[model samples]
Target: MTRPHDAAILELKNLLGPKGWSMERDVLETHNREARGKFEGHADIILFPASTDEVAKAVAICAAHAIAIVPQGGNTGRCGGAVAGQDQVLLNLKRMNRITEIDARDFTATVEAGAILKTIQDAAEEHDLLFPLSLGAEGSCQIGGNLATNAGGLNVIRYGNARDLVLGLEVVLPDGSIWNGLSKLRKDNSGYDLRDLFIGAEGTLGIITKATLKLFPHPKHIATAWVAVPSPEAALDLLALARRTTGDAIAAFELMCGFAHDMSVTHLPNLTRPLASQTDWHVLIELTSSRPTDDLQSLLTDLLGDAMEGELARDATLAQSDAQRKNLWAIREGIPEAQGFEGGSIKHDVSVPVSKVPDLLTRGMAAARDLIPGIRPCPFGHVGDGNIHFNFTQPLDMDKADYLAHWENLNRVIHDIVAGLGGSISAEHGIGQLKRDELAHYASAEKLKLLRAVKAAIDPDNRLNPGKVV
Candidate 1:
């Protein structure tokens, strides 16, 4: 039975036409949940807007009726940001998947909100350019969602986060007005930078309908190597050495604990050990150059040789071929998925200063183990950038629910350590509903007041993504 909200639903249905909107149960069910299965809700209707104008019209209708709007993109967020309540309307942007333009001369790409990250990457590659915002979910995650949450991935060490890669955005304001600020120019030092406001707002401040993203020259020569470092400190030292030796040629510097790699090898098929010797810590390093004559392979080889000689690395393996390079990356990328085969894993995507990464890992691991004896720590990620996926797999043979019950307690313990180290509880992921309370707890009263003021100024009605972020 269609609920009493059918009046508004019918109005939206007529406005969007049958193809653009749906009140179907299956669609609502699919759109109402987050990827992590941690948060779930219900939506009376789901609207699909193909263009910015259509999005504005839908927002206007929702605004007039005082109906809450939950703007979603690919529904790939780890947090409950995209989940909608029964009272709210689910606004899915997948149909807005369009690469409007690729300006190779200006080194920018104009894309609709729903364009998949991989699609944009391919489009840029076709023009012999690169869109470096890459993550494990690149295959499915959309650029809008990436920009909304200000995603930071493997390339963040070199390219920075999603916000750093964007030049402009076209947003639909809370009252149905559109902000056409999609400027491709590099320098637009106008009054306030409003583009930065919505980038990491997670759809709370405004709905991001389109974006103009920065691009780079495609790397012509690339080199990849996996080195077994002595410790997190050693990994940091190697990162410094690599940067000094290769200059800005260091494209990616990823750190993985030995146990994390072992889990990958144990669960993921076709992924073998990259390093010959077993070390407690590992770092996957990559160097790229647009100039084919750069000879990145020799540079990486020399860096690894020097690191081993300096005792920073216990052992090292440089990729001899393109196949070998991909194999090495596969091991790194496969860790997250392989972890699922273990058991219920409590995950924390935290970031500290690069100098404090070793301290965070050392102290955090000890604290978690002390809290729950037999807990397995699988900490890894962009250590060069200070963001670590500090995840804890359940103790062996432990009940999943029982282990998960300690999620909040364990989070406090780990987050307190992160706080002491002057780190962020969330690095890449934004403060969605999952971290909303935590953000309130950690953020100062002045910061919270400013956040609320911004939200009130822009969205006084509180109709856009209510109960999220601030």
Candidate 2:
């Protein structure tokens, strides 16, 4: 006997035509996994809808047949949020890639969910504006995925996350209803903000089709610096000092553990080590402003001098040119991929209060080391937002599978400490299939109940991105 979803798949293909549907093994293979390649699942069909109406129609058909649909973007997610399972229908948004509108005067850009992050950034730059939410994956990640996860990148220290960047959204509800909420208005307090509900819902409530993103004036004067610190505490102190001096001109403050920097230099090609001595901690700082007369370098230098005088930063180097700035940034941006090349790592994207970061790292690293004796803890990420990617590499000559086998045990140890510190188990990467169980374990009963109720209300059939988030 054929399942109802099988027939639904056929109906969808017929409705969408060849250009809108694909079942080729190669194409399906490409859609099976996320950027990390950790959680790959097979999909029987991949649907490509060119517009929100088509997406609504396909979703309605799938909902009617009780078929699970996974909304996918550029597939650059660290979590397995976008991968389609063998029993699911993959709804790819690449065909809908478009910049619907760019209103420089209004300080907003309306874009399709499938638009690449870099493309939108480029568009904003063309208009002498800035789209500040950026990460290493910006070249490949999509706006929908960013909104879905509420991504926190380097500039999050200043401009904030993807959620803050979005003013309004166009979403396809679970029942296939198109909600046209794409307003560029900065202040619209009509009622409950629906955009906030779906911004970080991880596609559990609905599929985001389009969005109106906030833009800022492009910075005319920019400065980049790499600073050496004795510890996370020192780095945190230096961060406070910089903020006090520059106000909000401080654009980014990224923390890099020496282990992580060393790994990048060891693994990545042409990546020279930045600091003269291997300090326990380092911070990549960036300052920017639209004012042509803004002396970001002088401000940065003054802040660094104060930090050094206060014994917060041991040494620092400011970038003299664009190439030098890029080189300094490459060390920070390449850490994750370099760790990947090293071996299979048990990764956690966790966040604690900025004040508790040092303690969190101290206790978490100690516990992890005791568990695996020689496990290498490479904790690095957006220190400005207090989010860290606490990842562990296998011990020297230890079997990779053996170390991975202890992932659950290690996670419990680390997460228990996080909970004690009033921190989140899954921060920016989000609770997709990768952290769904963790969500259940960490979220309060009231929060869990509310999330579940929202999911039930929007996607009663649980056909949209099933087994994702709450």
Candidate 3:
């Protein structure tokens, strides 16, 4: 029995050759599921295009047949942006992984969409440069997905998000037209910035095939510290103090609740607690200087001393050795993973103004507590940039499935608070299937109209990544 879209799938398979497309169960399972097991995706055929030409041809075939295309990278996204649906073609780009050019003089790297983030960072390091976009999934996540999500990571405090790091992108549009905008130049006063339109579009308008990314001088002098703060308010004060103290050397400023720290240690039993003095809140701060002569450690020590004296911080542990620095970072980075050990955890990636972060924390926690009593509020993240991974662990007595049932209700209350504070509901994470309706509800009518206009203008048939961010 031949299906209506079978010819399109056959065309893609023929175009990609035998090695390009897969119908195997295991391969489909991996490509179809979300990273956190929240959503299970579906696709009739999953493809692995080898080059830009192959991708363009495949997309053209799909467009001609009116077949839906779900462009996927490493599938490490939390928002399920790359997750495909029934009858859609999953265009996985892992085979296209290539760092085509690394121009040290230009401080730019042109890489294929499938290149692993950590691989690019190491490649940059080899040239005595730095590609600073980093997160928990750096080892597995692809650069294309990072750009699609406009990813913000540990370095965003000093460097900026993935959007800020990218100079240009090469995209295969819905109609299968290749737009090579891979410019390495920092400045371009063009009519309209088309690169940005595709960067965070989640593959709705186009499939990002490659990118030219900005790199910086690798920091030679580095300092890391775990400081205890009384509360979110004190954390903000410490953030201000560190920013002024470090100048442009500030790399990361993370805030965590006491329970978040405890969960990290518990998740990895071998992990060492960075600080002895446990308080309600903690801050993991890092400062880096490219200059070899900069006394970053001494400066950090002095800054911590001042912060402690001013009562902005309670206690601090400075990482004296590289091993100690790694230990501190390990504890800080393990927070996202540690949530899984606990029962069902409701997650929110929201951001408010740095000043209003305190209010967000207080009000959000209180509201969640009222909704679900004894639900452990494990809030933590890059407080320097005001993005908090405000998550709630299910109660001891509650069933995991039952607790997850309140996901929608919980999101509404917390998101309402975020709106009141003039904060973004989906900050670093894009509005994937998880928050598509939420985007519609919270977004202004004018903004929604414009977004739809753009989507319609690019993908007239809604065949490119349908059921995604509009």
Backbone clashes, each candidate: 0, 0, 0
In model 2, how large is the Cα lDDT of residue 284? 94
lDDT of each: 0.91, 0.89, 0.90
Error of 1 at 328 (Å): 1.5
lDDT of 3 by residue, 248-275 (tens): 6889999999999999988876689887
Better of 2 and 3 by TM-score: 3
lDDT tens digits, residues 318-415, model 2? 99899889888999999988897777799999999989999999999999988899898999998888899898898877888888999899999999
Can you give the TM-score per candidate against the true fold? 0.98, 0.98, 0.98
Worst 10 residues of 3 by lDDT: 1-10
lDDT of 2 at 122: 98
Q: Model 3: what TM-score? A: 0.98
Q: For residues 332-363, could you state the per-residue lDDT of candidate 1 as single tens digits?
A: 99998999999899999999999999999999
Q: How far out, in Å, is residue 303 in model 3?
A: 0.3
Pairs of colliding residues, candidate 2 = none
Flag regions of model 2 displaced more than 4 Å. Answer: 1-6
